[model samples]
Target: MNFPRLQGMTEALRLTQAGQLNDATQLLQQLCQGQAATGPRDATVRPRRVIDLARALPKAIASGVVSPGPAAPRATVFNGTAARPANSPMPAGAAFHALTYSGPTGTRAYRLYVPASYRGAAVPLIVMLHGCTQSPEDFATGTGMNVLAEAEGCLVAYPAQPASANPQKCWNWFNANDQQRDQGEPAILAGLTRQIMRDYAVDARRVYVAGLSAGGAAAAILGAVYPDLYAAIGVHSGLACGAARDMPSAFAAMRQGGAAPSRAAAGQRTPPAIVFHADRDGTVHPRNGDQVLAQFGAGLGMKPERQDGQVPGGHRYTISRYRNGQGEPQLEHWLIQGGGHAWAGGHAPGSYTDPRGPDASREILRFFLQHRMA
Candidate 1:
C-alpha cells in the first residue's frame, strides 16, 4: 500500500490551519486510501493514524484553526509538530498507551500522559474524565488538555468508561455501587491511580481529578470517598450530590429518565473544588451547577465571591471564587452566561459541547495546581 506522504500530511495540516475543511478532509481520505495499500509491516499503524486525522479534521474546522494531522496513522495526533520547524524543540515526555485494569464488570481502559518533568521526582497528577458516551482519546482531543498538562509540568490520566458499565459510557457516579466504601467503582478508579503512582513518580499530595457532565459527578465521588488520594476536584456542567439513589436510579437519572438522586454522605475530607457551568446550559440545568458550587462553598464555610471578567470574543464570565480561610487557596466557579453544557471555549466536534468562551481545560489545570491536601 502507498503510505500517506509526509508532504501531503504537512499540506493537509496547512489547509486545516487556513480553515479549508473540505480540502483538509479530502486529503485525509486520500491519506487513508494510501495507507490501505501499505504492506503488513506498516499497514496496521497507518489506518489508525488515518482514523485520528478523520476524527480531528471536523473539529479543527469547527474551531477555525487548522489541526496538526496525526503523527502515527492509527494513533492520536500528539507531537505532530515533530516535522515542524526544529526551532521549537519537542518536550521530552513518555507517550502513554491505553492500559487496562479490572473493574466490577471486567476490564476498563485509561490513557496516561506524562511530561518530561516527570523524572524520578514526584510530580502532580491530574485525572481528566470524559462525559457520557466519550472515550479517553476523544476527550483528550476535544479538551486539548494534554497540551496544558505539558505546559504545567504535570501528568495527565484519562479514565475511560466502558460500554459494559453504561451503554452511554457514563461513569456510575449516580449509582450506589460506584460510590460505596472500598469495593466499587471508586475503588477501581483509585486502584488505577495507585497503579499509575506505583509505575511513576506521582506526588500523592498533588493528585487531582476533573471531569465534565457524568464524569464530573464521578470526580466529585472520587474526591468524596478517596479524599486522601485526590487533593482537588473540578466539575463542569454537572450535578451536585443527590443525583440518584441506586444503580437503577443512577441509570434513570443519566438517561434523564428520572429525578435527581438523594444526597449521600458528604464525606469527612473535602478536597478543594472548582466548578464550571453555563447559565444557559440546556442539558444539565444551570441550577444543578449552582448546587455544586453551594455544596463546596458551604464546606469551606464561605460563599462565592463574584468577580467580573471578559473572555475571548468579548464574552463575559462571572467568576465566583471561594476560600476556606485567609491562608487557604481559593476555589473558582465560572458561570459562563451564554455557554452550553460543554467545555467552555471547546470546539463543537461532538454533542453536549459548547464553545462559548474561556478554555475550561486551562482553568481546571490552574485550579488543580493551586490547592493540595492539607
Candidate 2:
C-alpha cells in the first residue's frame, strides 16, 4: 500500500475507534479517490485496488461503513419462491441452467438461457450483467432479455455477483484491478463468455455484452479492454470506462459527471456501443451517458443523426445515431425524457424498472444484431 493510503487508513481507524463511523467512511472514500488521482509511485503497484473494509476495521464498523445500506431481499432459487413474476413463461425445449466458472481471478456462478429454437446451429450470444442487489432471475425478468432471446433464438448469459465480493453485489467497475483486461472481474466475465461459447455453439463474431448500472459500467470497461471478445456493448445508465477509480469518485461521478475518457490507443477498434440513460435520472447523472458514447469515439468530431419518439402513454425519448467514416452506425444514444434511474420499459416484477419508457431490451438487441466483429 502507498504511504498516504496507509496514513489515511490509520486515521480512519482512529476515527472509527472514536465512534465516528460516518467520518471514517468519508475519509476512506477520500483516500481512495486521492490514490486514484495520483496513481501508484511504483509501476508494479496496482492503483485503486478493492479495499477489504472488514479486515481494516471492526466487523460492526465495516458492516455499516463499507456497504451503502441494507440490501433489498434477494431472490434465491433455493427457496423456490418468486420475488417477481418470471420474465416470461419458458417455451418448450428452452432451458435455463445454473453454471459456474472458475478462473485465475476467482470463481463466479452464472445462469444461461437457451432458447427453444436453438438447434445445433450457431447463434448470437449475449452476456447480461445485473445491477447491484439484483439476481439473474430478477434481472432476466426485469429486462425481459430471455423472452427476447427466445423470440430471436439468441443465447443469453447472466453473470451473478455475490455479496461476498461486494456487499451490494455490484460489479467493481470503479476499481483499477477490475477495469483491466485479464484481471479481476473483467477476466472472470470474459472467461465466462468464452466458456459458454465452448460449451455451446455460438457465433464468434456476434458475441455481445449488456448490463445495467454498475454492471453497465462493467460492460463499458469490458468493451474497452477486450474489444476482440465482444463485438458490441449495451450500457444502460452507466458511466464511461475509467470514469472513476474509487468509491468517492464513483459517488461523485454518479452525482455530477465523471472526467472525460482517455483517448483510445492507436490501432484499437472500440466495439460499437448503444447507451441508454434518462434525462431525469437522480442516482446517476445523465451526463455519464454521453461520456459512455464518447469513450467509444462518439465525441471525435462525428455528427449524429438525431431522432425523437415517444412510447404510447409513456415517456418521450431522443435518439442520436453516430456513424463511422464508411457511414456505418457506430454509436447510438437514447435519452429518455422525464425518466428516472431505472431500466426503461422494464417489467414490473423486477426491481428498479420504468415500464413507461421505450423497451431498452428490444432496442439493445436490435442494435447488437446490427453489428459484428470484422
Candidate 3:
C-alpha cells in the first residue's frame, strides 16, 4: 500500500466520522490531484456541494434521524475526475417519490421514479446505486437513466446511503457482513426491490440492478448472493464479489485487481451481467473489469466472442461476449479505449460520465431485457 496516500485516506475517513464531511471531501479532492497529493498536503479544497452538505450534515447528525447506511473513505476513488456540467438543465418526465425500505438486515431511504406516461401496467424496474457523495438526483442526471425510463416506461429506484451508515456515503461492499445472502446491504437492497415491485406494477422477472464504482461492487455482490431477485446486473468500473473484506484489501483491489472471489459449484445458477470500464481509468484499475467477467464467466464452460469497434468522434472499444449453449450472450464486457473512470456515452449533466464511448445505459438495458429471473 502507498503509506502516504493511505494516511491521507485514513485522515479523510476520520474527518468523515467526525462529521467534517466537506473537509474530508475537499481533502480527498486534493489528494486526487496527482501534483496536489505531492505538495503542501494541507491545501484547502472545497467542492461546492460538499460545503452545502456540511451545513445540513450537522442538523441531521444532531437529530439522530439520519438513516444508518453505507459510506466510502473518499468520493474521488469512486466518482472519478469528471466535471459537473454547467447550466445543465434538470431532467423531467419521470415523477419521483421519496420512500423507505426495511428488510431483515436494516432500513434505508430511497427515491422511486415513475414514468409520466404510466397508468397501471406492469413495467420493468431498475435499482440504481449511486457512488459516494451522490444521491438519486445526481445519479439520475449523470446516467440519464430517468430520461430513458420515461421513454421506455420502466420504474427506477435510487437508494440513499446515509452518512450515518457510511460516512463517505458509499455502499459497504467491503464489509463481510454486507456480502452475503439475506444479510446486510444485499438484503436491504433486495427488500427495496421487492417493496418497489409490490407497491408498483413491476414485472418481477424484469428487475435489474446497476451502479457505478463502489455501488458497482455492491451490485456484483447482489447479483452473486441474490441471483433470484436481480435478472441481470450492471457494474460500471466495479470489482468482483468477495474482492476485499476491508480497506486494506479494497485499496489493493483498486490498485491491482485482486484475486477472483470464491463462488459456488458450477452447476449452481448465477445472474447474467454487463460491465463497463475504461482502460485509462485512474481511480479503479481497468483490470478489475477483466476480473469481473473472469470471475463470473469462469463456470460457463465456453469461450467468449471478442469483437472490436470504435465510436465516431469518441472512444474506441472492445466487446467480449460469453454465450450459453443456445448461443445467447450471458455476459458482455465493454473495454473502452482511452476512456477514464466515467460513464461511457453519458451526458454532461451528471458527474463522472464520459459521453465519448457507446451508450452504456441503452446497451445495458438491452442486454438486461434479454434475460429474466427463472
Candidate 4:
C-alpha cells in the first residue's frame, strides 16, 4: 500500500534518517526477521520482502550509512567506510581474513576462512555467496560453516555482493552480464576461487560453490558455466541457472518456482548439484526444488532414492537423491513441507533462515564431499 513497494522498510528508513541506528537496527531485527515469526501485524512484511528488509537493514547498520531512498548505497564496493560489527575473531583451529579482489570485472570484497590444521597440504575449498543484503559474516554466523569446515579440515570463502550493484545486495543472477563463463559475476567469482586455490593449499579437484536465494541462483549459474571449477553446487531456496535473464522475468520465475524444468543429459561433465526449498515458501514456489533436481539429473535415466521424514523437533521434509550409472549422486533435492523462503536448518543472525529439522548446511556439505571434479 506504500509507494516504497516494500512496507515496514519505510519506518525503518525514517529511523535511519533520524540517526537512530541502534533503534533502527532493533526495529529492523524485528521487522526483517528473515523467515522469523510473523503475525497479523507482520502480514505486510512478507517473507520475501522481509528478506530484503533484513538484508538492507544489516548493510545500513554495518556501514554507518543509508541510501537516499529504500534502494541501497549507490556505489557497490565496501560502503565508502561503513563500520560493521567486526566478525567474531577467528578461532585457533581456523583463521579468517577480509580481502579484496580487483580484476577486469572491477573490485570485489571477500572473506576467506582458513583452517588452523593447514600446514601446506591441499584441502577442499568452498566459495559461499550471500543473498540480498547479507554480508559474509551474517552468512557465516547463520550457516555455522566455519565450524563445519574446521572439523572437516576444509576451507570456506564468502564473497560479498556490494549493495551498489543490486541496491538490495542481491547477486544479478538474471543479468546477462553475470551469467556467462568468461563474463560478469561468473568470471569474477571464478577468478576469486582460482585466486584462493593459488594462494592456499587448496585441492582444486574438490572446489565447490553454494549460496542462498539470489546467491543460490548464482551458484547454479557458476556450475553450468564452469563445471570444471566447482566439483559440486548447493543452491538453498534458490532457482535454477537461467531461470531469468532480467528483473521482470526474475520475479515471474520466483513466483512460478523457477524456469521450466531443465533437460540436462546426465554425464561426467554435468556437475553434481543439491537443492533445498520449502513447500510453504511464500517467496519461492516449492516446485523450483523439483526443477533444480530435474536439471541436475537431466538425463542418464536413473531412478531416485526417495525418503520422507521430519526433523526430531522441527518441520517435515522429503529427500530425493539421484545418481548416475556409476551410482554416484548427480542430484539430491530436499522438499521441506511447510517451509518458507528461508534457509532450512539455518540458525539466527542471518536473515531468511528457518531453523527446522533437516539442516541444509550439513546436508549440502555431505553431498558436496561425495563428488569431485574429474
Candidate 5:
C-alpha cells in the first residue's frame, strides 16, 4: 500500500467532513492527477475509484452541502472591477446606486443604473443577473451593459446573490423551489423589479431581463414564470426554464443538453427570447441555446431566417431569427463558432468574457428594445 497516498486521501476525507469542500476538492484533484501519472498501473490499483471520486466532486458540493431552500442573507462587499473603459466618461448626472429590497420572500442587494438622460419620462428597464462567483459590478464591467444602458437611456438593475446563499454565489436555478412563480428566488427577483419600477419611471411595456451562465438559467425561469412582467429575455450560455430540478441534473444539463422544458401552466404566455451560445462552450453545452429558443418558439409554426456574419478579426457566427405571422421576430439565436464559456464581445476586466466575439451586450439590447408588452 502507498501509505503516503492513503494518508492524503484520509486527510481529504477529513477536510470534507469538516465542511472545507473547496479545499477537499482541490486536494482530491491533485491526488487524482498525481496518481494517474505516477501510481502503479496494476489492476489492484483501483483506478475506477479514483475516477469516480473525481466525477463526484462537483455533485458532492452542489447537492450535499447546500440545501435547496433560501439561505440566510450574508453581507458581502462589492470588490469587483467595473467594466467601464478608462477613456469613457459617465454621463453627467448619471448614477449607479447600490441598494437593497426586502419583500415577503426575502431581502437581497442590487445595483441600479440611472442614465443622465432620464428626466421623469418612463424609460426601458433591464434586469441583469450575474453568473456564479460574480459580483454585480464585475458582471456590469464584463458585459458593458451599463455603458450601453447609458447610451440607450435605459435603467439597468443588477441583483446581487451573496455567498451565504451558495458558496459560489450562484443563483439556485437548479433548485425546484427557485424555479416557481411567486416563490423562492423568483419571487425575490420579481419583487425587486417591481420595487425598481415603483421607485423609478420605468416603462412597464418595455421591461426586459438578461443573464449569463447560471444567471442566464435564472432569467429563463423568470421569463417563464412571469411572462407578463418581462417583454423579453436574453440567455447567454444558459439552460432553459425547468432544465433541472436539482444539482445532479443541473450538472448533467450543463454537460449535455437539458430535457425539454416543462409545459407552462395554463394562461401563461411564453415570453419572447434571444439566446447566445458558443459552439465551443464546454461548461454549458451549445445545444442548450437551441433548447431555450425552442422553448419560446414552440407551437408558433414560425420558421427561422438565418444569417451568417463575422466579427472584425474575431469569431464567425450565425444568427437565426424566428418571426411571427406578422413578421415580428419572437426569437433570435446566435451561435459563435469558436467561443467558450464567456460573455461574447465582453470586456477583459470582468471574468468569463471574450472580447473577440460579437458584441452580445449591444445585440441583446437591440433585440430587447424591439419587443414590448402587448
Candidate 6:
C-alpha cells in the first residue's frame, strides 16, 4: 500500500464524512491516479471506497452541509448554449446538470452524464462541445455519445454555447481574437473544466475534448491553447485552424475560406489530435480536410503515411500518423470519404448524420485512451 495515495484517500474520506463534498471530490480524484496504477488487489480497494463516498456527497450538499462550487464562468452565448434550462429532466442516470464558471460574455451551461458503471472514483471525462444551432440535448441525441460513455465507464460533459452570445450557438472559432491560447472562449472553457474537476472525480490524465462543425473548430483551438489541459482532441466535419480573427476578418474568412497554417514547424506542447472529416462534406469542403491532415503531418515534423483504403461505408477513409521532426506525433488525421458534414456512422436522425460504418465516437475514445499529455 503506497502511503501517499492512502493518505490522500484518508483525507478524501474525512472530507466526505465532514460534509465537505467539493473538497472530497477533488481529493478523491487526486488519489485515483495512484490507485489506478496499483495492482488488482490494491486497485479494487479504491474504487469500492469511492462508491461508498459518492452516496454521501449529494446528501451533504442537499443538507446545506456543502454548497456547490462557485458559479460557472460566463461565456459568449451562441445559437444554442442556452435553452429553457435543461428542465427536460430524465431519469437520474439518464442525465445530470451542473453549472460552471461563466465568462465575461455569457453564462456557461454544462450537462454531465455518469454511467451506471461509474462508481464515483476517477473516470475519464469527455467534453463534447456542440456546433452552431445545436443545444447540448440535440448534440447528445445526434452523436449518441452517451451510449459510448456508459459502455466505457467514462463521464460525458456537454459544454453549451449560450444563445445569448451567438444566435447560431456556434463556438466563435473563426474569430482570431478568440483563437489565441486561453484568452476568450478557450479561457472560459478551461474554467468550465476546473468546475468539472471540482464537481466530479475526473481522471486528470485522461481528459479529452471533441466537437462537431463549429464545435470541432473550437476543439482544435482548445488543444492548441490549453495543450496541457486536454490529453487529446477530436474534430469532426470542422474547419481547419486559424478560422477566426476579429469580427470583420472572421466573417470574411468564413465566407472566403482559409487554410490552417502548417503547425508542423512550431514546437509546443500541442496534444495529439484526431480529425474526422468527410471528403464529400459539402458544408466545410473536402479541401479543408487535406489542409488539416497536412497541418498535422507538418506539425509533427513527419511525412504523411496513408493507410489502406476504408470501405463499406461509401467513404474511403484514410488515416495518417504524424511523427514530429523527432519521430513523435503532435497530431493525427482521419479522412472519411463519401461521409458528409455529419457524425460518421451516426444514426439516420437527419441528412447530415451518417449511420452506416465506423463509429466516430468509438474511434475517438480509442484514440484518447492511447495518448496523454507529455
Q: Which candidate gets the maximum lDDT versus the true structure?
A: 2
Off by over 4 Å in 4: 1-49, 52-90, 261-268
Ranking by lDDT: 2, 5, 3, 4, 1, 6
Stretches of candidate 2 off by over 4 Å are 1-86
**Model 4 — TM-score against the truth?**
0.77
User: What tens digits encode model 3's per-residue C-alpha lDDT throughout 259-369?
Assistant: 676664577677888999887765567888877776666455868788988766666789988887777678899998887667777666666666665778878878887
Could you tell me how far off, in angstroms, the CA of residue 357 lies in candidate 3 after the best superposition?
2.2
lDDT of 6: 0.62
Candidate 5 error regions (>4 Å): 1-87, 265-267
What overall lDDT goes with each candidate model?
A: 0.64, 0.79, 0.73, 0.71, 0.77, 0.62
Write one digit per residue (lDDT tens) for candidate 4, span 67-161: 11111111111111221222355667667899988778866899998888888899999999888778998898877778778778899999988
What are the per-residue Cα lDDT tens digits for candidate 5 across 263-337?
A: 556667778899999887756778888888877874468888899988766778999988877788888999988
TM-score of each: 0.69, 0.79, 0.77, 0.77, 0.81, 0.68
Model 2 lowest lDDT segment of ten: 70-79
How would you encode candidate 1's per-residue C-alpha lDDT over 59-148 as one tens digit per residue?
333222222221211112121111111123336655656787775534668999877666678899898888876888778766767767
Clashing pairs in 2: none
In model 1, what is the error at residue 294, expressed in angstroms?
3.0
Q: Is candidate 1 or candidate 6 better by lDDT?
A: 1
Candidate 4: clashing residue pairs, number: 2
**Candidate 4 clash pair list:** 34-352, 93-116
Per TM-score, what order, best first?
5, 2, 4, 3, 1, 6
Q: Alpha carbon lDDT of residue 308, candidate 5?
A: 93
Alpha-carbon runs more than 4 Å astray in model 3: 1-94
Number of clashing residue pairs in every model?
Answer: 11, 0, 7, 2, 1, 38
